[model samples]
Target: MGDGATTTEAGPESAGVGAGLTRAHWWILLAAALGWMFDAMDQRLFILARSPAIRDLAAGADPSALPALAGWATALFIAGWATGGLVFGLIGDRYGRVRTMALTILMYSVFTGLSGLARSWPEFAAYRFLCGMGIGGEYAAGVALVAEAMPARFRPIALGMVQAASSIGAMLGSALSLLVGPQSRVGGWEGWRILFFFGVIPSVLLVLLRFRVPEPDRWLRARDEARRDPKPGRELGDVRAIFADPVLRRRSLIGMTLGMVGQIGLWSIGLYTPELVRDVVFREHRRELAVEADSLDDLARAWATETGGDADSKLSEWKAEADRHVGRGTLLQDVGSLLGAPFCTWIAIRFGRRKAFATAYAMSMASVWLVFGGMSRGVDALWMLPLLGFCTCGIFGVIVVYLPELYPTRLRTTGMGFCYNMARYLTAAAPVLLGRLAAGAGGYSRAAIIMSFIYVLGLAVVPFAHETRGEPLPD
Candidate 1:
């Protein structure tokens, strides 16, 4: 078997001294960051596009069916994402990070582009599920590729930089939706279709990637020549190896727990903020409508007794006024996401990953409390909703850097994929549980408090983890 130790001229010293960055390291960082940026953009675009598309598709249909469909689509997408991470993570370990990264990018980009062609909700959901498969694979491949390529001394920074790039993509998705959404000629469902079509631009990146990136020398050297020579197509047993060792087993378990907690908070609570905002807006609109209806009814009674004008016209005017308020609320939620993402990115880098993650979750819990509690009290605490988003989003950047350092190169992708993606299972179900709780309690405040307690659990876990700040990647 070929020992996994391919030597490269570019070693730890090439990462640059304390004062500056090296050119090669810069190139590696840029490549990974750019790839991750697009990956984030593609994943988020689906979420951003969902509301308008659902509204159009559910037009004249039972209102309850739309949220149900959205929930189903989200579950399917996460499943596909988990599958991609597991399958490609093994492939990355056996083959090469560079090759796997290129393949993953192409796979995701192509499917995301194909999503633009979907005509039915089922079709759109299927495309998104497929796109998610590729998108999920991208993280392990991209993180491993950059980590392996860069000097050990700079691994965290490189990975952190890549993680931060997700914010750029997310922000871009928000901007794209805002700009093209209203201006789209397709109207309703068609506008969403146009947005998906624009997703094709990332595929062009595949061609550039083919020429620019090279497979990491580390994986090439790690390849067991004896194994490869006799059976070139044979796959290595990374999963078996991960559990075969005692320390690795512990690390794997810890990593998975961390991932599950992180993802549940992120996917279930964090991603649904927009929906929550919409609900709040809807409730407010209903209140406004009721107030207007009562006023109009009183006016109509006076008019009937005096001038004898029509009641139906006054009712219609009140309905239009309520609709305007709902529309404005939706717009605010969308616009707020863009503003929130950058701040989140900045916080992750500035405050450190552990602190940043804890803070974000803390804020999210508080925000949910304010939303559910403050609403009944007639407090306009809507701003806390987006601030929670800003805090939660910062954790993505932290995870990118933190997860890679948790494993050695031999099992980096495998460990990361298992830890990061498998957690989606927990997250996938979190919203439903939260929804049920919200229904039972007649509000989301209790659920928010529950989520806050989970964050406290995370705080306890963080201290047990080894601090990797400025530390070299473990050998």
Candidate 2:
């Protein structure tokens, strides 16, 4: 690869001395981190809510058919992600990062809230696709802003931290799932709907971003320079520019492939933890549910005749038990993710970007195999969930740190967004493909095991990766 096409190796101290990271830099990181955090939370909320929403929508349909419908919904969401990433990435480069960030946040938040109003599966899927577009745009904008703003020494660490913040969003989503549970009713409405209604929380960040954050100096300078001496295929935010040259095209292909590997693993495998929890761990609660059902029937007469206190108490008790037994598996996985995300930063700092990515990919493959192949008990999942999260989710830290390094400032957002979000097109098929595999193979676990080989492609890409550790962003 041409040197300018990718990050060149730099010594630890080569980040070199300048004015150092400023107050503006810190503010930018915070803004980017918050945007990414809320974006991730929105995604996690969908993951937790998808099955329940579909189950409710298809109440009268065959139970076995729910997975297929859910898969279709996921595909639609992924398609939206791909579309938003491509379109907004160009906008980010040509317009500005902060403005695009605000627009995307609004788009996603409004759509997510609207998803709660979806009375049918098709309606829900449409809302989710729109939400996915907003979610998809935020990543490239936030990461590009932070990458360009921070000092070189702090760039990787800041990018990792920004990526790490996404785990907090996922954790919050898990907490929301736990708080509401699928069966809980509020104002006679299902908890899943309420959870989506709350998806508007991220929209609140728009004020902070618009009022507090400023566009990066690098982007401003590059924008001015591009206008002054524009060249063919070198226009700001032009998607065609990314593929106009051999070096950029090669880097773009590798970067997108790397992103696809992680996206496939996450959307296809990691997001299914809730399903496993429901099917495997929650199965043990069947007897408890049966007992509660019998008790509820007896209490119904008492509720009609008496003051109804006893029936209310019994219902509350059952709801608590059900909430405790359900979603625990997915929540535990979130805790694991919290730990894993930061670990990626430490790994990238200690080793290099390539090593960190390779390690994460290898561990993800193995951990996934162990989780799907042998995990039959809830207790086993407690320990294994963290390992699975650490590997699968940690690799993203490397991606945010590494991808922008592959492009110059004028094309940074466009290239990074295309590489990351365009992969969604391939990954968008993950749910459908896995659904078929699960049905044909007779189980989710078996299909997951077969899917685990996708990580090997990540490992193959490692040798060709452009090492960005301690290096400045390409100028």
Candidate 3:
């Protein structure tokens, strides 16, 4: 192994971080972090865009059926995400993380822009799935690059901060949605479509990644050795190798379980929060809108009966007003995310990774139920969403830092990608189930609470987790 790829060794984190990093080190961190930030922005944009885009694309469809339709689209997106994570991770391991990351940015940008032109639900879902490919690939490559590039003394800090930067990206997404709201438009384009178009702008960042960033010295060395001895191809993202080794296989199972809990909870829950808030606000605006109301058609009817106005125009106005508050709720979640990620990182640094995972999962489980069960007011979300965000998102800091520590340089991205994305195949079903449950007496809130139970599995898996604190990266 090269100096860049030291085997796990016990050591204390040093205060020499400022002295340890050079100009290039900072550049690597910033570049990887910003790419991840923009990726987060794309995720948030989809959350905000899903309902409106589905409404437009699924024209003449029953309003009550839109949630299930959107759920299916989201399922496709996660499916794409998992596939891309697996494939691009191999590419990163065999080729170069820098190039793979840059290529992913280009892929997502083009696809997301194309999503804006989707005229039907299937077209929109297809575009989102393709866009998810780019979005999903960026994580393993970015984390692997940063983990390899940084020295052990500051690797955790760098990884945690990189994960932390994503909250800022989420905030930017929320702010953009706030500015655009529901009724705004550009050249007759819906605000949701315009938001998808903004996905192209981040492709410019590819220049920095492509021109300035270099392959980690660790990966370069690994590639040289793999070329010399091509047998046992585990050195190049072989899926079987992760399963062939008993220790690695066990670690992979634990890691995959932990990753799935977060994936299922976050994707299913975040999908509906803004809409949940919109419903709450709309109901508050009109007393006649019942708690059991399952669709916007109820609001349309209420406006027509009570306000004696054009139902279509009134529905639009209500959505616009409620959307403003929804943006705030989303922003608060990001704010909590900003703080929680670092907090969990600090816990991992102090305690063990298992304990950190335990804390995050328990809190996440509680908050998920809180948000979905009787969290009916936007004002309540001011506090609830942040609590939810802190619990649900904080574990990412541990995830970003710890997964790379589990595998050697050659298999780092590949292992992390598999652990994180493979479980997404199971998670793809969660939204569909939630959608079905949502159409029942319990509605979105009840279904989301049911889905949140997946977090309990996170807690269950923690006992088997390997503690990686103060350990150097594996060779």
Per-prediction TM-score to the true structure, in the order listed: 0.78, 0.89, 0.94
Evaluate model 2: give its TM-score: 0.89
Q: What's the lDDT for residue 97 in model 1?
A: 71
Clashes of 3: 0
Clashes of each: 3, 0, 0
Candidate 3 residue-wise lDDT at 470: 74
**Winning model by lDDT:** 3
Displacement of the residue 2 alpha carbon in candidate 1, Å: 18
What residue runs in model 2 are displaced by over 4 Å at the alpha carbon? 1-19, 282-326
Comparing 1 and 2 by TM-score, which wins? 2
Candidate 1 has its poorest 10 consecutive residues by lDDT at 1-10
Residue pairs with colliding backbones in model 3 are none
Model 2, C-alpha of 268: deviation from truth (Å)? 0.4
Deviation from native of the Cα of residue 388 in model 2, angstroms: 1.5
How does model 3 fare in lDDT?
0.82
Runs of candidate 1 exceeding 4 Å displacement:
1-22, 58-61, 182-189, 224-237, 291-360, 371-382, 435-452
lDDT score for residue 409 of model 3: 84
Poorest stretch of ten by lDDT in candidate 3: 1-10
Candidates by TM-score, descending order: 3, 2, 1
Q: Flag clash pairs in model 1.
A: 2-224, 2-225, 4-222
- Whole-model Cα lDDT of every candidate shown, in order: 0.62, 0.79, 0.82
